[model samples]
Target: MGEFDLIARYFTRPVRRAALGVGDDCALLSVTPGMQLAVSSDMLVEGRHFFADVDPAHLGHKALAVNLSDLAACGARPLAFTLALALPRVDAPWLQAFADGLLRLADAHQCELVGGDTTQGPLNLCVTVFGEVPTGQALLRSGARVGDDIYVSGTPGEARLALDALRGRLALPPAALQQLRPRLEQPTPRVALGLALRGVASSAIDVSDGLLGDLGHILKASGVGACVDATVATNLLAASAQQAVATADFGAQTLMQCALAGGDDYELVFTAPPAQQAAVQAAAQASGTRATRIGRVEPAPGLRVVDGQGQPVAQHFASFDHFA
Candidate 1:
């Protein structure tokens, strides 16, 4: 089919008043009057983002979700998006499922799919998401300060573990496999909670390149350092410890490695002043999302992971590298 046929068949649809809806070079949106646009772009490449055989529907969800996660890091509310898709051929079934997944997220988040280009090439998807936050109020990596508490949302490393299972490094029960597949394939973008954090979080970034590496972005941007207690940050592994140990497995350590270095978690990592800690906690509780304090910002200018006795561990940058 042709471009116009594809648009009418899948993308064009009615949207809420906040979004002017499709059919333009750019989408028109009305945000809170004085806010500035908060925009982010992400690209997903086949074989890198997913196996060639992975489900198209999940792939589509992830391409958009990752971009939305970037906007969330800036505490921006969803406005609209543009998608640029490159495919080897126009497989109707694949396009249908992909569009279904994209529309599902757009409708839920109230973002209209405005415009994009389609071309002949290896499979790749790029999405640019638009959002808005009050002027001078967008949460940024540079705003972290000494004495700020570092926090992360939801559990980490599950996606990486899912990858391990996919690669046959470990065996997962059918139920566990089903549970992890969605997380590995399609992650939820924490938009509402992130927008709720505006004015509350001092600095923010999503865990796109694992916790340690992504946190390093905040440290570098803020011109500060951090000391993360791996003990606390690795607590999520405790939940699976029984099963891991019972199976005579190193699953716990694997999970830790994944949490520390695996990209694609897409959960938010943020800092807040100690004084606002209570307020941040209350907000997360109200939203029914778990936000855990995993570390603290320091005046020194290096990233360090310390043991209980405050001794430093050997560290190496172990996250995803786009050009590696």
Candidate 2:
């Protein structure tokens, strides 16, 4: 099939939230009176981001989901998105499945697909998502303050566990691997949690790059230090991963590395003041997601990991870096 034919057959759709949709040269969006537009872009290349044999449908879901996570970090409600897709060759079945997955998630959040480009090249998907937040209520990395309680939404590091198992670096039972695969392949973007945290969270960021690295962004931006309870953070792994961890004999250090630095977790890592702890929990409940308090912002200027007894743990975990 030709480019335009492929786009029309798979991606064309009516606009619900956008002024102009797929066929147009540009998508037009109107912001609410007191809200500001929030925009983020994410790119996924075949081998770097996903396995060669991954499901096309899951790839579609993930391409957009990662971009949505950025909006979630800013406490924005997803409105619309534009996709720029590149394909090595036209496969009708693959395109159909991909479009189905991408549009399904878009429909769930009322995010419309706007305008984009399709080209002949190695498989790649780039999505630029648009959202909106109250003019001054958008959560930012610079807003965290000393004494703020550091909270993480949902289970972090589960994706990393899935990654290790898939890469053969860790061995796991088939059942355990099956249970953990979704966490890696199809992550749930915590959009509701972000919306609920608008005024409650002092500073917020989605944990895309391992917990420490992403949280480090908030710390550096806010000019504060943090003491993360390693025990508490490590215990946040999902049950399946915990089971896999037990069987792998990967030792405490490897476990800590995955739990603390495993990237690709789209969960939110945010901060709120001690007084807002109740509110934060309320928000978590209201959003139908779990939020755990794992640490506290401190006057010191670097991230420190400590054991449950308040004794420091000597270890370093680095997050994903494209250049490094």
Candidate 2, backbone clash total: 0
Q: What digit string (tens of lDDT, one per residue) describes model 1 on residues 1-324?
A: 987787778777776654556676666667678999898988889888899998888888888899899988898888889888888988899999999888888778877787788888999899999898889989999999999999998777778777887889877665666676787799988887788788899999999889999999999999999998776656664454334344435454565687677778889999999999888888688767789998899999988887556887565548777886
Clashing pairs in 1: none
For model 2 the TM-score comes to 0.97
Q: Which candidate is the best by lDDT?
A: 2
How badly does each model clash, as a count of residue pairs?
A: 0, 0
Q: In model 2, what lDDT does residue 268 have?
A: 94
Q: Candidate 2: which stretches are off by over 4 Å?
A: 238-240, 243-250
